[model samples]
Target: MPTDLSPVDDALADALDDERTRQRETLSLVASENYASEAVLAAQGSVLTNKYAEGSPGERYYGGCEHADAVERLAQERARELFGADHANVQPHSGTQANLAAYQALLDSGDTVLSLELRHGGHLSHGQPYTMVDEHFDVVHYGVDPETGRLDYDAVAARATETEPDLIVSGYSAYPRAVDWERMQTIAEDVGAYHVADIAHLTGLVAAGVHPSPVGVADLVTGSTHKTIRAGRGGMILCGEERADAVDTAVMPGCQGGPLMHNVAGKAAGFAEALTPAFDVYARQTVENAAALADRLQTRGFDLVSGGTDVHFALVDLRETHPELTGAAAEAALESVGLVANKQTVPGDHRSATVASGLRIGTPAITTRGFDAAATERLADALVDVLDAPDDEAVRDDARETVAELCRQFPVYDGGAVASA
Candidate 1:
């Protein structure tokens, strides 16, 4: 019943159809994941991928660059407006590389840098020992307050004042609260340090006006396009006009060689879509759905880390649900059902980070699929049902069937109908 297709096109089309099948079949709760739009996909697959421009727009090392100029310039202008930055560099290949480039532009070898500890919700690129930047820079640690489960500005300030660091970073991979940029700026100013706000998780929210922008407060900003922006995987660095040249230079020569032009075009499409008014509603609803899910889990006797959330993610402590359940067992059991999520370590966790005591659930993908509070409530009920009967293969299979039914009803992909397997 299918139309005739060329061999190459048919193979590619089959791959895309398989992708659609996967998205429709699974409930993605990974915080860093999102479904890029059709426009984004087109841009990424555009002819821009053939270019080898090695430098910034208008100053490329290569000779032939008529279209690359337009694509790169459009990306820069849109990013500048969307984030309220004086100038934007659309070149960094990943958020980690973006942070590394910023450090390259600012700090000297072995210069002391301050950031949140990775185990306590910070990213590895933010001075984790495993990253190469650790050897280039002397790293000190900070963390959220034990009582509040949010960034303790006073503690960060005190650390900055005491250490007199070169750069002060305020960002997280797992933090769920909105950052206090003003306080962060103040602390950086007092200690004569440069501030970098990694708003990777909140870029769409900030662009949509659902969350406050962090571009002007910090000297530098780094973001990921996939998390909140609904773009494909890529990184971006934004800076004030004064440092734009240095930032660009650092990202190019200092950190990486060639740029991911395809990803940059995808970022361009994402930025355009984020500037729309409806995205504001979507971003707002993401937080609402997260809050609703967290509340439902709490009412169902799960202990939420930091008690709750103000954003799209929640780190849930599962001791109440199953006192003897290790996070590894919980994750396997939950996955056996269709309620997908990841095991995460909580503060004072008794188990290893890899085998955590809790699971981290996010709302971005389901939110993209149009699952609101009522549907999320059903999700919470499914989780509770699984926990209530941990060993029930029948229950797990039933839950998976239930999830597949929901997925079938609310299919992903631009066609509205999920491609048949």
Candidate 2:
């Protein structure tokens, strides 16, 4: 039985209950989101949160860390096994932090770093102006091929050579195709630059062997635990034995303090789940569902970036299909009908970041709820209906009804129980 939060915090508990109800009823299509399993949730909300293990597993600054150490060790071991890395640091609080520590470990201040442009599917930590990385490093950006909306390795190589960067950052936030890690490695090698592959969005796919792994190919790798991996919110860094000490130190006293042991336990549970054969099936289905979504949307006259997807999401470039419709307008229209997705910047986008020209719809969350290709096609149809008539009250009403029916068919959480705040 779960402890009731109503007695201690009625207001917060009510809000949490409302949020749970929202998730149970809506079709969440956010590309970076996923529904963690109950086991992972329990581990995240466990008692380990109270402890302060300021150092690595076996070398803690505080006492009474036996269980914390054990959990961290298990999480690291599982991560190494899952991604085939020589070492794993499950300490950084988020993917951004993991990238920061990786940069600190590999390069010095003022060293040039070459990475993808933020509007071109790269993360903010990869050298956005607002980040500390930008303040410390000389950052150069490479962009995707405008014709294909895919990374052009030749362009990246040319950019690396032009900048003579100390590090080259690969992997992305919104790209929908498989990356050639080996080719990127070769480019970094030719430029004499260390490669840091930020696989924050494809952690589970790589772990399940559905996507190419960058662990052994890249000089350093980083990822988020919560995105595709179904772990609690956290970050991880993977590196070879030669760089293990530097990466570990950079993650600890270099960027952060005590580790979140409960989240580490959650990572362990999530990685263990990923090791099973069932997870491989889930990973493959995620990609298949995205492909189905792309097909359905393209059939309805929508223009998808790259013409389709090779991963768990599809980027719909709405410029040609709906020139007057901004991504923000489409996002609101879909949300009104219980289909939640985020506005995104497509290649050659002229709009601001807040009002992008594209929509990135993902299948990880819906797939976790047991949605297959057929169900995804239905979802795509409903999404198109809303986008086609965003301001029509009758159309939104019909879409909402369809969403409610689909929610009934595929619920996110069993028993519809909302845990206390």
Candidate achieving the largest TM-score: 2
For lDDT, the strongest prediction is 2
Evaluate model 1: give its lDDT: 0.80
Cα lDDT tens digits for candidate 1, 1-421? 1223446598877776766667768887777777777788778988888988888878888878767878878888888888888888878888888888888888888888899877678888888886887778888988888777778788988889888888988877888788888899999989889898988887777777777778888889998877888864688888887898889889989999878888888887877877777677788888888999899988988888788988888887776557788777777787776667788776666787788787888888788787888888888778777877889988888788878877877677746421210
**lDDT (C-alpha) at residue 420 in model 2:** 13
Cα-based lDDT at residue 148, candidate 1 = 70
For each candidate in the order shown, give its overall lDDT on alpha carbons.
0.80, 0.90
What's the TM-score of each model vs. the native?
Answer: 0.93, 0.97
Off-target runs (Cα >4 Å) in candidate 2 are 1-3, 416-421
| lDDT per residue (tens digit) for residues 193-265 in model 2 | 9999999999999999999999899999999998887877899999999999999999989999998888888
